[model samples]
Target chain A: GDSVTQKEGLVTLTEGLPVMLNCTYQTIYSNAFLFWYVHYLNESPRLLLKSSTDNKRTEHQGFHATLHKSSSSFHLQKSSAQLSDSALYYCALSDRYGSSGNKLIFGIGTLLSVKP
Target chain B: EAAVTQSPRNKVTVTGGNVTLSCRQTNSHNYMYWYRQDTGHGLRLIHYSYGAGNLQIGDVPDGYKATRTTQEDFFLLLELASPSQTSLYFCASSSNSQNTLYFGAGTRLSVL
Candidate 1:
């Protein structure tokens, strides 16, 4: 069984400040697909960023995360937080490769609060 | 826009009642999934189907039955629901290794 851990339950930050949410995963698979999904209040969780290549940074919508196989982590980071960035963030994992391996395992969500 | 739509945005039912949650995807994706989200807990996989007439048991399949009747429709059945099953349910679909999941608005179910 694969599991993802998002250590932050709530993160509050002033607008324009940098933001980073920690995510670490434990899985026996070597090529695990890592992802970040964002969910606004009353909305479904939407995919934000994802990467399967180790050490390659993947970025989307002003956020980025890199899969560090050596560290077994995929931490999401942003240089500056925006008011629109306030949402619930989740990290996820999938064992298989390509389109056929679509089963996903998700982590507990992190609630981000961006103060304007 | 890619969309996965779920029916019955909210539901209220008494214990021992029967409930069926429906999901439809327009992206023509091959994989469909059902998950439940609880307070302070991450989304838990309930069940998933790879294609029409195919179903796979997920991490939390207890008290739930799923059917994939066609490429576009997937349903979750809670026969004799209980209080513990009260939670937010979401349906999602993907185009195989796309890494991008299109999710439905979600359904809030309560069992008394």
Candidate 2:
């Protein structure tokens, strides 16, 4: 069984400060893909970033994450947090060729609150 | 942009009522999925389908059944809804098994 873990349920930060949301996963497959989805209020959740290459960084909309296979981690980070960045962040993992098809395992989401 | 549309943005039904959540994707994607979002649980997959007439059980398939009527449509059915089934439901579609998912606005279900 595969699983994803997002240690923080809620993270509050001041505007312009650095932002980091931790995400880790456990899977038996070697070819695993990690994804970050941002859900803003009153809108559908959209893909923010994704990576399958170990140690390579994937970024989108000022957010960046590097998939670290050695540590089984793919943490979302931003140099400066913005008020508009306040949203629910979800980390997901998928074993592209799993026996059960393309099933994605998701972690408990982290709600990022940026205070002005 | 990919479009995944879900009907009845909000729904309310009795505990023993039958409910069907509809989803239609215009992206022509081959993969469609149904997931429920709840506090502390993030998003749990209820079911998914790779194509028309295909269905796959997901991580949390209990009390739920899904059908893929066409390449662009998928439906989730809760034959006997319960209070525990109350949550925000999202329908998504992807071009392939290993591609990005386009999500619908979501359906808020309340079982009373």
Interface RMSD of each: 1.6, 2.8
**Which digits, one per residue and each the tens of the lDDT, describe model 2 over residues B13-106?**
9999999999999998888999999999999999999999999888899999999999999999999999999999999988754468889999
The candidate scoring highest on DockQ is 1
Every model's TM-score: 0.96, 0.97
Cα misplacement distance, residue A58 of candidate 2 (Å): 1.5
Q: State in Å the error of residue B73, model 1.
A: 0.7
lDDT of each: 0.92, 0.93
Q: Candidate 1 on A1-116: residue-level lDDT in tens?
A: 68889888999999999999999999999988898999999988898988999999999988999999999899999999999999999999988778584888888989999998
Candidate 2 structure quality by residue, lDDT tens digits, A43-105: 999999899999998888999999999999999999999999999999999888423356778
Q: Score the docking of each candidate (DockQ).
A: 0.74, 0.56
Please provide the root mean square deviation of candidate 1 (C-alpha atoms, Å). Answer: 1.2
Candidate 2 Cα errors over 4 Å, as ranges:
A97-100
lDDT by residue for model 1 (B4-105), tens: 999999999999999999999999899999999987888998999999999999999999999999999999999999999999999999887575779999
Compute the lDDT of residue B51 as modeled in candidate 2.
Answer: 92
**Native contacts present in each candidate (fraction):** 0.79, 0.54
